[model samples]
Target: MPKLEPEIADEAPCSAEFTAYDEEHLVTYLRLLDAETDGADWREVARIVLRLDPAVDPDGARRCWESHLKRAKWMSGYGYRYFLKKPRGS
Candidate 1:
């Protein structure tokens, strides 16, 4: 099945707690992690996964990619605990 791409923000939310935005972008985070694991270039990831063209907006794309990748790492490391602890069907 094809995944639906969500609109991205210029920067991902940076909160100590997992955020609603995080929940919405779970697939995106996973894709980012997978891309990193696969040794994909940041520019390619930005254009393909993030839907941002680095050539057109290098700084914006870089910022978005960096912030989201950071958040994605955080999600993999610590934020998964939040999902584990969350009550079902909230």
Candidate 2:
């Protein structure tokens, strides 16, 4: 008897693009409201934004995250722990 396996093939690799993210960080903060499951876990988003400036006030960041998420579609239908799946787009 022989073992069978799924065939895999070599394909083109993806290359990262340098978009000068650091040199042109957005000074404006934004957020979106999650009416579906949560008022919006703005704190998590704020912490991520603070990577640009550790000195950034968390409360302020939460405000910004709220504003930004208000425009997000998923934000309106999810809770604090909700996160959009992509690639496989689960």
Candidate 3:
């Protein structure tokens, strides 16, 4: 796991929809998702996150969540990326 700077982390603008876990947490999650192991119950993860924020639309949140997991630096040799447009009416 890697410690990411705030700029490319969950602190980024909301449009990016980036979700970040701390280094230690990231490691454990990925280990549970390891190939040798049975797959994690991602639906539960999805359900929890969607419920965590009432503002989140399930479909959109799920997509953002999937994107975050793919290369959120939680998996071995992965990297974090943050990008988003400034919000409208700002």
RMSD of each: 2.4, 16.0, 10.6
Q: lDDT of candidate 3?
A: 0.38
Query: Model 3 Cα displacement at 71 (Å)?
Result: 1.5
lDDT of 2 by residue, 1-90 (tens): 111221111211111321122112212111222222445344554444333222466555554444444423322334212222322222
Q: Give the alpha carbon lDDT tens digit for every residue of 1-90 in model 1.
A: 114588899999899898778887899999999999999999999999999999999999999999999999999999989877877776
Q: Which ten residues in a row have the lowest lDDT in candidate 2?
A: 6-15
lDDT of 3 by residue, 1-90 (tens): 333222122221233333434333344335324522455454555444322232455555555445445543334343223222324343
- Clash counts for the predictions, in order: 0, 14, 0
Note the Cα lDDT for every prediction shown: 0.91, 0.30, 0.38
Q: Where does model 3 exceed 4 Å of error?
A: 1-37, 48-56, 72-74, 78-90
TM-score for candidate 1 = 0.92
Q: How accurate is candidate 2 locally (lDDT)?
A: 0.30
